[model samples]
Target: MASQSLAKIIANQQLNSKDYRLLISAPQIAKEAQVGQFLHLQCKEGIDPLLRRPFSIHDYDRQQGEVAILYRVLGKGTKQLLERRPGQEIDVLGPLGNGFDLTNTADKVVLVAGGIGVAPLVPLAKELIELDKEVAFLLGAANELELLCMGELEQLPLQLKVATIDGSLGHQGYVTELLEELLADSYGQVFACGPEAMLAAVQEITLKAGVEAQLSLEKRMGCGTGACLSCVCKVKVQQGSGFEYQRVCSEGPVFRADEVIFDE
Candidate 1:
């Protein structure tokens, strides 16, 4: 990874009741970024949390020299991130992890995101649209209050489906429900990111339907550069006899559906 002090914070604002969005001035990273990639953010006070919080690169403006990260305030480290203000310099080590391989696209492309997991998928959707593919986004959240970037995602050049478990908004039930309905029609492949359980559910559904899929994993990572091996997960090799562990922070937060041995 190209290591350097990118930029300071331009804005850190709460996007919802449980989430916050941080806009950083990282021109270099933005200029070379792609969808499905993430950054290892160095929390202020010297990693007192003892790990760099990993977040998907939500959106980036190369022209403006900025990048955005959307995170849910579900833990102490995240809560600290929420307290960061404009002009404070935060160290970030990324544009790390492999992104979606949109090499093959069909007439229809489905992007599935769950909760804060929606962060990576948004950028993926933006790329698919630019490729002239018809895009449908399935977004899932626990309630209306937790639905992130609804307005922003709706503005994308694609069809957006919202699912809430509490039926507070959009289609009721899990995002998998919406995805199952859409897959009945024709779609080339599926791309997803979210809680492991949600991703596993998606994986099972897509695999059974004979559709190709890639899942972006959200794992706690230490030494985001892969030295710690803390983010490793078992992956099934194409022609190997057994599963081996791979670094989620480096090799992927993204992997092909059949390649991963989901945590049970």
Candidate 2:
């Protein structure tokens, strides 16, 4: 279920020049949200930026009735969001979109994240750890500066690996290259959230290795409830040979890696 409310901003802090973390008070939303779910946020009261912006739920505290969002200052909408201060009430509709499936009994799992895509996977990692699963994280960024959330993630019990395109980080290449080496091990399941190009590469690698994978996609959205059809993506039909459009906002922000058909 989803709800609309004026969530009070409890805390807001800048992680860097481009990224921020926002905490809000929304008990109903916090209680219902799952890993990979998102919130559609109205940045301002007026029609200046008419459409609401979509943000992935980075973390939530059900007991405290709080939810956190990690975002980058990408454009007008996010810039407006950056200006928001604690104690302000902002319009938000959330616990929207399907989340990653954690029902697998696999003992070993791998989570791959790139850039800010690491946001949604935090909760997923926490859940995996709670389930007593052996988890590993493979993170990638263009450079060391873009490797957001490293401090927060290090607090977890999972194995961590980092890669940067510039040789300034752990591995001097794409994270997918590191994934290729990790795939040689017998991982039960693989989950990823990143740029489409990275997801496509992960899909290829997982497909070749015959390992199951789920990918959380990021897309532009309007009505988070699936009425607008603005967040549709090409998906391979479950029972047929052809492809059809699926709403990323409702049907998924998460989908099987093999079923997503990326544009070439």
Candidate 3:
């Protein structure tokens, strides 16, 4: 169990039109964070926005005692998070959920990100590199205007690819199109995050290619650590033919991609 707290915000900045980055000094939680794990942030003030907003742990500098959240303003809670200023205190609970698994001895690894889904992968990529894995990352956005945090990704030891729906950037179609091209080559495994539709497409491609995959699901969460059962996603059992629902906050925000049944 982790200590819950009203941590003081150390920094908040707009990253782009729909997204922002917040840095909070949650000392105890930061100490236990792993890649793909998330934080359930309680809005400052009241229960009108009662449920905590789940944000992926973008990065954690344990030595600095800070955790970062890169979030998109999709609704009221997120909007409030975006408006928060430095020094504001907000309640938080986590390092919740199972994160990406990075144990493969595979020489080549592919990571795909779509829109704000890129948040959780940043730290995962860093960890892959530390293990000396060859990492290739593919990122997609609606257009150049909505793109976020390319600079930080580019700084990593990753062979990066970018795509825009309007052709303003790397590829002119969905990121999956680029992924299809990469599949013709030899790669160890694939990891991805994005809209459910996009994740579904990645699921389809990886399944056909016979490539192993892991997916991070995005869902609305309430209790954030399984008690509420609010963030349930249907996933296949790792060993069985039947399916079951797993709490995204606990069994995963991350899961073996093959184990998830993406259709609603």
Candidate 4:
């Protein structure tokens, strides 16, 4: 279920040079939001940036009736979003898209995030921890400066590993390299959200190891709902030797890692 509301921006703070954390007072959406779900925000008042921008729910405070989204200034839409002040009202269509399924019997779960893809995984980590599941995180970025949200992630009770291309951080390589090493320990399941290259590597690693893995994808969307047919990804069908285009906004943003067909 989804709801549309004019939510008040309670807090909008810059996390880094490019990324920001936006907290909004939207109880209806917060209560219904799940890990891996997103919110579609009408960024500006005018029609200049007419279409809404989709942002993953970074974290949500159920008791406080608030939801937060982590985003970076990538274009006109997000730049407009950044200019919005606290107490300003923004139209939010929320708690959308299919989220990660936590019902599996995976005692040891691993979360892999690349760049700002760490957003949705925050809530998923919290939920998994609450279930008494042992969890670990492999966070990677191009460099230390691009690595976002380390402080918030450290507050959780989980094993954390960092990787960077410039060797200014934990490991001096791709996060997938760290993941490969960790996979040797035999994690029951893995959840990943990152660039296509990262996800493809994760898919190969998980497939070879016979581990269950879910991947969250990022795409340009026209409508957050399925009507616009804007955000679609190729998914491998279960029964056939063919692939089908599935709506990333409605059918998923999360899909089985092995089922995703990444462009080479």
lDDT of each: 0.87, 0.90, 0.86, 0.90
Task: Indicate the residue-level lDDT of 133 in model 1.
Answer: 88
Candidate closer to the true structure by TM-score (higher is better), 1 or 2: 2
Q: Indicate the TM-score of model 1.
A: 0.96
Q: How would you encode candidate 4's per-residue C-alpha lDDT over 1-264 as one tens digit per residue?
A: 567789999988998899998999999887898899989999985544355999999988889999999998999899999999999998998789999988864999999999989998888999999999999999999989989878878998999999999999999999999999998996999999988899999999999999999999988998788988888999989998899999999999999988999877
lDDT over C-alpha atoms for residue 186 of model 4 = 67
Error of 2 at 213 (Å): 0.4
lDDT of 4: 0.90
- Per-residue alpha-carbon lDDT of model 1 for 89-183, expressed as tens digits? 88888789888887866769899999999998888888888889899999899999898888888788899889999999999899999989899
**Tens digits of per-residue lDDT for model 2 on 1-264?**
568898999988998878899999999999999999999999876544365998999999999999999988988889889889898998998889999988855799999998899999889999999999998899999889889889978999999999999978899998989888987888879999998999999999999999999999988887888888989999998897999999999899999999999999
Q: What TM-score would each prediction reach against the true structure?
A: 0.96, 0.97, 0.95, 0.97
The residue pairs found clashing in candidate 2 are none
Candidate ranking under lDDT, highest first, comes to 2, 4, 1, 3
- Candidate 1 displacement at residue 54 in angstroms: 0.6
- Mind giving the per-residue lDDT tens digits that candidate 3 earns over 152-250? 988998999999999998899899998999988898799998999889999999999999999999888888878889889888776758889989989
